[model samples]
Target: MDTQLLLLLLLAMVLMASVAQRFPENSCAQYFQYVQSGIGSFQGELTLGLQNGRNRIDVRFSQLGAHDQSVVGALLPYPDEVTVRASLRAAKFRVSLWADASAVLPKLTRLVYNNNELCRASEYNPQSFFNRFFELHINGPQSPHRVAPTPVIHKFPEGQTDVQIKTVVFDGSERSISHILSDFVNEQTATSAADWAPKSPAITSISSSAVPRQRWPTSSVPTISSIAPAPWKPATPASPFIPNGIRASPPSSVPWPSFVCGQEGTGVPYIQRGMEFPRGRYPWLTAVYHKESFSLAFKCGGSLVSTSLVITAAHCVYKIREDRVLVALGRYDLDNYSEDGAEMRDARRIVMHPEYSSRLQLQPDADIALITLDSPVIFNDIISPICLWETAETETEAEIGSIAGWGTDENGNSMTRYPRVVDAKIATVGECARRWKVQKILDRTLCAGNLDGSGPCLGDSGGGLMIKRNNRWLLRGVVSLGERSTVDHCNNNQYVLYCDLAKHMTWIRQYIS
Candidate 1:
């Protein structure tokens, strides 16, 4: 009740508030106590420290009333992390020390937070069930990065045993504690099914390791059982139907388009029962024609990427005479040459990816090509270039990439009148590799299709594999190859390969603005 005592209490409260407001100039730490209740009770503790962008983590886990244990302690670089990979057996685990953590933290933070209570439980709120013991906020403004809703991590099973993960932190204000906790939740609760899925190296360390799995040593430093795999590099693919012959071209030159690319186009609304894309639906779709004696035949598909540039599969033009090729932009119906929005351009030059080869069967290696139009094509509502995909991250899991072209349809018949457009589910890198038995599929090729006979067919070569984002269509891949049917047409039962455009950005930018 004395004045001195009241003043001392007020000062103490203010000091506590300041500590919660911000960390010291370059040092901070946090601790967490993880407890899981039920059948097999579990308890653990984690400590995290950050100083000068570097991270130090120490974790100890024990099954309640039992001696079974697991511990991970490591000092990681700014963008590195410690990952724990366990198989069916709880003890059969691979603890990778200092794997690349860059992919795991920043990306998850940028995702749009959906109203998922379980995932929200992974947040770093002090009052939450996960229990955040302490946190030190950075004094500066919060990060402004935002992204679309990312996949949410599911919660642990209820009842007998609850897995509680406790983590401590130090100087991790730049990288918030919430992001770190979310990453841990994802790693800890991953299902066996996800083990086969293609995930970023930071999340799943499924690579050839020099070290073998073994018992952990009774020491402060966690033993490293594996070295992180090098980053996944994009590979490429090529068309299969084009005949081999020398393609010729004159000294090529053309002006670039002045307007923006990848603008939305107006056409008939999507009809679930129909596969035929209406006129003006895809302004960038170009029918590549092979000039025959006094006539032209639709040979392949192409995409208008710029006023002067068209992208297609390398095998479509490789070794084929460029002079005999004609590119018709804004064309929809293959049978009618004088459709309202059709315009044909001469091929001034043809350039295949330097690494592309026609001899490589079932391999889509460097399968992209660029064609130089003789002159700049004027843009209209029905004739515009599509934007190239520029996202650094790979396509999201189960995302759909659309294919539209004059490929053959069901019943083994050619689409002689109009191009067909279909949405195909993009397959993961591991799925692609396993289906085709080609490890090189990881780098430059993307695999996508439906086993329900719904995908690109014969003559769909060189067509664009497009994905829409922000109301604009982005070119993600070029149709390359797939299995052949017993009748020598496309095998719709398998996934098809396309040349991943992201891998060839450096080469593409040299030719584009």
Candidate 2:
């Protein structure tokens, strides 16, 4: 072989190798990386990977030693991250996608950014966008991560409702919740909940399953990870439960504070004039217990927000320092706590709404509070988290709602033994204001009861005035102040006041997350 020819051939081979290196092996696996030192101490990688009309993104933190919450990254220069997030609000952001996919791929229809179909818009309908959507997989969502949950209730042009529950049966043990509820229903007779069972949103009506299996083009269902991510949107992904601008999404499992929604039925004995809840009628119903050095007494009522959370009133837990506070769930009868499903756990932390100044007495405004249990409780039918009302429908069907507690009875006696649940009608705030004085009926307060003297009494403070819908019970309000004339005595004639739960979701979820 000629020496010159051999040298030319070697040079050509080397050039070809360089060209091969320049081009990627898998065209679809191309990605763009952004190193965000993050707001405050949060330093993470925001990445986007692209494939055929699909996108997968991961916003992950670069673990630089352990995070020191005390570290003030502010006070320094640009290289050092800020300790506070105030700057984030004023800054205009820019997201850079490295590939030519945006310009080249115009027919892009489907998107799986952080496992959500972010962009449903095509070229003609390019108006939808979800802003500030990012998913960081830190320890498989066990720790804190963004999970956007869609709203359960929405007004539709077609007059239909979109529920977000996944129809596919992914787990053998995971049967339809309706079936579990139905099974619980058939076991016995009589309930304090409303008579109507919750109607399941038509399976076909569920709007957020990333396009049903039948709707897809006949080929293969694409795994979300295989696709590159798309731009953020202001709209949440379709869902059966509404996070309602709460989080990017809810946890994979049922979101925290998942109480039963809209349940009311008849069949029981008594709480005062209130009927006794069937063995475990109100699963989320709990008693906030103040555990003293030698004794434990449940003086106020609460509702379980999650496996590790409870919701009560500020007045119930604010200053009763005589005992360490604890939360008890699923206790049927105070006399017979040996009743099944009742579990007690110390409150690890309590977050009273910052404005809630209720001390020994029930304040009409800002009476709400949240209690973080030391550990997550094992949830059962009798012990579980209840859902909060997404919308405040003060006037429920027939203007009816119910309150359950160990208040005084019709005989003008205190509710010392068997507690009862009873029905009450929603009352106008204006009337309540007139009855109590302008300053008494606060904006956060709601009044409900019967004219015939069928309402909450003493010892019912901090209890919930619940409303039933769709077979689940939603916490509508926390018992704040009873009519002063009837505070010490049992009187259905005077309307009872409650701190509206529906109005204070923003303040509640802030600490819950």
Candidate 3:
């Protein structure tokens, strides 16, 4: 496997241990926003984007980690996905999504395995799948429920679409599926016999030809009209489902881990999986270094958006007590400037947003700034400028973007000597309002980060939140001030504010040309 995939597996293993309490809630949920926005019953399988971050863990049988797992009540783990197909055996449990908990409950019949009943939800609690809420049941192997069914595969007939699914009764109480041979069965007689089973929560069973027909149940079996229902309708126990990968492995005895993004406010959490960025992938990420500190320290980030312009936060230059602030780019290792091919330039002129005063910068449009380089930058595969976002529609389809920088934590600490890249997802204005307590998030302001605990750290104050469009990266937002929740050097869970470059393109064009 590739290094990234191997690293991803390792990180997933680690997250398996600690994600319950520390995983960022809603960090990777953009893909499911449409489901939350739409009304009515929703049934289907979706691979929600919980990427990079350690994933949904089965907490039913293991140790708990740092995330907010307690709130995962209703959406616990249910057998909603066990569609009543031709081969469903009696005693297995499975998990599936249901828009309305109450509506699906009446349909859940007891699951019987090895002559023992399993997974009959004894209790339930509500959970938020996104903006909408859901619930799962309290289930386990040791509960009043029975043992896990040991699956034993048997050869069944396939030619000409003839298959016999039979349920056998043993000792007058227990039931089990007896998969009989299907090759020689006749159609008309089999159809007449199938009329004995229930239409919904259907169970298919065919007795041996030697058994008397009087053994069949006389209950009416309803047949669905030949007409197909709308494609997205919720799956009934009687409906067939397009196969999916979710919950199909490791058997069905374990409880699912929570997906909430709650974590302790320790140093910003590490990147979802702490995967290092490939060299030269993000050439525009620049380090804005200060001279007076002499620690050779840089606490802010900037983007080489044009040949002669390095865009950053106004507060970055305003707070610099020193006269010199150097812009360095085109290399990974920040400590060794002579490493391979790197470039450093002096700021020829500093231009702050007209409304950007240092005192008020923490509040509004006062956060953006630009630096004019003394010389034009030489473009290369390793160092290039990004495109500006210019579109009639301000809204973008992208929900997540990456931020790059050479920055560290609250105490000026760093895990890597090289500049690093991390992902941040765009959050709603309401989320920004909650994160930034002191100032309101204006229409021109933007917020992003779960960072999987990676950044928007102190040193990345002026970095760019870049979205890839067409085939090039576009500048969307510029790093600005933190709401009090994330002013620390590294913020893992809270959203960070940015000055929306999409709203300031006219001003940027005026200064750049």
Candidate 4:
């Protein structure tokens, strides 16, 4: 042979060796062709190499219809073997191609190449061959292409799909393909792949092999549709009788002054002595009277301090005939009057503290009254005894004290008799004096009630102004006058003055006996 011929032969042998080396020791590359002789027909499957590498295969398809045909495709990667399948069905003809797994080259170990040149064939093209062979879709059919509908993405692990592929290499190296299809599905579903073909509609068959089924209702039942009922509304609260602005005052700013006597020509001395009751020991105490007939009556609460001495407010004794006064002691409920209930006593003489004035009745001295009962009250739970005054040189106003009367709560709303007695801290003399503009808080009287409007009102007068000393309840003062003005001139101030017991301990003792 000539030298040139020998060189050409050597070159060809080298090329063959290189190609053989590229494939798995025994794998071979294959080509496939599919012809869709009609419109709206397609089928295909792909296999991936276990190892990471490129794969090449040849594919062909035919378009025999007047309108453009669609083809669905899928790629599945595997570890041991790779399979490629494609089918095309037309009205007149059908074509199918399947690449055996064992015979095909491992997808991970092959090199792929494409033919850039374009050609038109009868009912088929070379581009399909390349795409199907390599398990990839090549760019073609730009116009008149059908786009696949987007897929809906769901929260994963719940709606995840798994795809796996396997291939067997001649060298016995196994490879696998596994991935969560959800992410890819989600991305493809979200993005519009311009080159993708629309999915084929699912195929169904009605053949003789089908069994007969029982007839059932196909029409949906008409629903008597109803809506949820509207939400319930809340009832309104009761409006208070006192003015909203008046009730808004702080409980500590009320202008309550000390009740004073003897300076005003009232035969009553500045101080009087009486039996002193210790705290928590007033179990002998009783209610001398409680108002029941008058719903709006101001004499709702008072006590019998002595047998003849019926202690009450001058105002409560105001505007009423002395005959109307009926004292009920030892009673829990005013509406229920029985001998076994609160002891009932009649009033013969009602002598309000002479100095007790009502000019504004704003002064504390004018707030007190001494009503002399026709007969002495017998002590019982319904008519228990309350300890009276103890004469002292002077009683400090800051002494921790309590006022027990049938007064209203912070809102001036009356409470039931069972829990009528309300107690609050006494304001300092300086604070009370400053707020009320009283020059001298008499030695006979001490001041109580919050500077606010929280002191005695209409009914609380003449009630015992008891003090708690060493856990004993003492009558320190009388619940005399709260803010006297009906208009609440001292707005926002809740002060109340009491007839100081220390000044009257002597008189109270003599008169009660």
lDDT of each: 0.49, 0.45, 0.43, 0.34
Q: Write the per-residue lDDT of candidate 1 for residues 1-513, one digit (tens) a residue.
A: 699999998888766543333211111112223222222222232323222211112121211122111112111121222221111011011111111112111001011112111112122112111111111212233323212233553432222122222122222113321212211211111112110111111101122221111111122122223333333333421111111112253334432212334543332001011176444457688888888889988778888876668998887777777798889887766677765435788898888888887865634668988888876554443566677776545644577667878777666565546766777778878987787786746478788876666678767889888875533567988888877766646776688888888888777666555
Best by lDDT: 1
Q: Candidate 4 on 1-513: residue-level lDDT in tens?
A: 699999998878766543432222212122212222223222232222212121222223322111111121222222112121111110011122222222222121111222211122222212122122222221222222121223332211322221111111111112221221100110001111112111111111112112111111111122222332233222432111111011112434432111110000000100011111111123223344434566324254554444335565566666556667766554444344442323455666665555666654354555555555555432211223333443344434444444444444444344333324334456657777776786755444456543334344554556666653321234556666555454322222455667665665554444332
Worst 10 residues of 1 by lDDT: 103-112
Query: On a 0 to 100 scale, what is the lDDT of residue 431 in model 4?
Result: 71
Candidate 3 similarity to native, TM-score: 0.44
- Residue 492's lDDT within candidate 2 is 53
Q: In lDDT terms, how accurate is model 4? A: 0.34
Q: Per-candidate RMSD vs. true structure?
A: 22.1, 22.0, 26.1, 43.3
Off by over 4 Å in 4: 1-300, 338-340, 411-417, 437-444, 450-455, 484-493, 506-512
Q: Candidate 3 at residue 324, lDDT?
A: 87
Instruction: Please give each candidate's TM-score.
Output: 0.49, 0.50, 0.44, 0.39
The lowest-lDDT stretch of 10 consecutive residues in candidate 3 is: 258-267
Give the per-residue lDDT of model 3 (tens digit) for 104-177.
21112122222222222211222111111121122222233222444432221322111111111111111111
